[model samples]
Target: MKLTVLVDNNTYIDQYYAGEPAVSYYIEIDDLKILFDTGYSHIFIKNAVSMGIDLNAVTHIVLSHGHNDHSRGLKYLREQYALPNARLVAHPLCFRPKSYENEYIGAPFSLEEINRLFCYQPAEAPVFLSENCIFLGQIPELYSFEKRKAIGTTIIDGAEREDLCLDDSALVCRTDQGLFIVTGCSHSGICSITDHARKVCQDQRITGIIGGFHLFDTDSKLEETIRFLSDLSPDMLYPCHCVSLKAKAQMLKYMDIEEVGVGLTIQL
Candidate 1:
């Protein structure tokens, strides 16, 4: 499997690709071309073109959650590529209307528009997109330190309720070494997501993890999270997007954390 960072919150000093406070990863596994979480704007498209990646060939577009930063790029993506054959995969609630403090923070497209644009696959259970890649559906709470937290309100059946981000999920790629996890903001909690990935894949070893951890302050939760990750001892960790530098600094004391940026590529 190979993965390319099409959009991220940072860019290396010499690398000239665009950056945004968002996430978008282009992954190739087996014969499948998957795009995980479009960024907040058209930056993903620009970065992809710079990387010489043909977005039109993407076979699957998987959304990590309904948050705008993770999913709003769909509007820009459709403008350049038809992607008639690609399938849209995400939790059923990922396309609903969501807001935080009276500001929209959901996918740019609605469920109806998504259904009309591509082959939509609403999955609440783990679904294998390829022999080595599996889209982890709704993550279950597996850790006490990392519990589901509400970010905003989402409309369900015409009623608004606190969004626990039940739609948030991740993708796991199985390899000889272990599992390589690709996630969005990890509103579901990175440790919880990792545990769920291990349970679903039935593998204890994790080779690496990339994408947002949503950890900010260097609080007790960060300490416990670092301990939890230290126990797993994954080969590498690339926590970006919503993860704060202070949290990254705290994590650096215990584990290997790679710097993620646009134009970064990893082959495994």
Candidate 2:
């Protein structure tokens, strides 16, 4: 399996490009091609094309959550490419007329916006791309400390949402070597994602982790996360997107890590 990062929150200082937002990643695994999230805009498409990826060839678009930065490029992508049959997999609430509120200026996408963007396909559920690849829809929260972090709180119709991370989901792949997990923001909590992967794959070790860890904080939850990962011991850690520099530094201390960003490719 090979993974290519098309967009991310931080580009290597030498690989800088203007207008791209905090994070995004495009991954290629065996014969399957997947875009984890579309970045904050159409920039992902531009970056992918510049790097020799043809959007028309993508077979699946797995959204990790519903925040604009993660799902915003959908409209542009479908307009620019020909994924007429590509399966878009995500949690049922991904189109929950939501926004990110507490962490930053949360911009909840209006239902009208979703309709205009995806041409209005109702939120999809667990979708299997291949025997070895699967999308875990509506991940069952299974950890005490790993509760969903409060982000993107929005008023849907009348009620205020405190845990509106309904758009969160995780993807798992059972490669010949072991299991590989690709997440978007990990808003549902990283530990929960890994648990779901293990449960679904039945005793497969998580060999690699990629995409936004949602650890962009001064008081970020790295210490506990490190302790948790120490038990799982994934072979490699590829931190990108909302992961903090401090978290990356700490991850290196615990396990093998590969820094990733736009235009970079890795053969796993």
- On TM-score, the leading prediction is 1
Model 1 deviation from the true structure expressed as Cα RMSD, one decimal place? 0.8
Q: Candidate 2's residue-wise lDDT over 1-268, tens digit each?
A: 7777777766777765533654556667767887777877789888877777788888777777777888877767867886766766666667665545345433245556645544333434556677778787877778776676666465565787765586688888777668888888887788888888888779658888887777765343677777787788887778777787877787778776787767777666
Predicted structure 1: lDDT: 0.92
Model 1 C-alpha lDDT per residue in residues 55-82, reported as the tens digit of each score: 9899999999989998899999888888
In order, what lDDT does every prediction score?
A: 0.92, 0.72
For model 1, what is the alpha-carbon lDDT of residue 163?
92
